[model samples]
Target: MEAAVNDQPRRGDTEGFVLQVRKIGNSVGLILPKELVARANLREGDRLHVAELADGSLQLSARDPHFAKGMESAGKAIRRYRNALAELAK
Candidate 1:
């Protein structure tokens, strides 16, 4: 099935895309168009984070802010304990 772009504004300031959910084996998924994928800077094998907004709308993003923050903190910790970690590994 094809995705239909709705020109009408939905839920205050957002536009809606009518997508068809298809069954893939035991899982159901939506087929995103190439144009949309390219516009979103997404490619094959990239991870996407899905979230449900307060209004129950689904949001998809290539990057997770929380995960990025956690990774940054972990990197700082690793750098701070590099010598200890190396000694422990020996």
Candidate 2:
């Protein structure tokens, strides 16, 4: 007989629902649940950025906040000095 499974999200993660990493051809990967994928707004081909925290924990997000902030600053600088940048580009 098979054990019953509950499909619900909780405060704690990977407790009972452990995501086992296995070899997929050459690379090892984990298979996420459909519910989790929908909650994260992730698709099959969507790119994810993984970062290691100071506490030795890993974080996964669609985009890098650090890079996004840097780009935002660069955009502001370009807008403020558009004429100067245009002259330099020539």
Candidate 3:
């Protein structure tokens, strides 16, 4: 899916394309265009964090620095207590 954004649009112009919501099996999803994905540096199976702004607009980002740091700390703890975790799981 190729999309072309008008090159001469003024700043803050709301000239955005509308995407249809499609049913994917039991879940619904929106298909993002390949060009947009490439510009975002996102790939298949990559995680995206979506947040709703105060104006009801949605923001999608590829990386959440805070979440990444929390995950890194959790990973270190898990590695340090691997044996204890395994024993607890038994």
Q: Give me the candidate number with maximum TM-score.
A: 2
For model 1, residues 1-90, the per-residue Cα lDDT tens digits are 433554322232456455567666788877676667788888888888998999998888899979899999999999999999999999
Residue pairs in collision within model 3:
none
Those runs of model 2 whose alpha carbons end farther than 4 Å from true positions after fitting are 1-17, 78-90
Candidate 3 lDDT over 23-84, as tens digits, reads: 66787876776666788888899988888899999977898867899999999999999999
Check candidate 2 and list the clashing pairs.
none
Question: TM-scores, in order shown?
Answer: 0.57, 0.61, 0.54
Error of 1 at 2 (Å): 13
Clash totals for all models, in order? 0, 0, 0
The 10-residue segment of model 2 with minimum total lDDT is 1-10
* Residue 8 lDDT, candidate 1, scale 0-100: 28
lDDT per residue as tens, model 2, 1-90: 222355333335644345556566787876677777888899999988898999998777998788999999999999999999999999
Candidate 3 lDDT for residue 63: 85
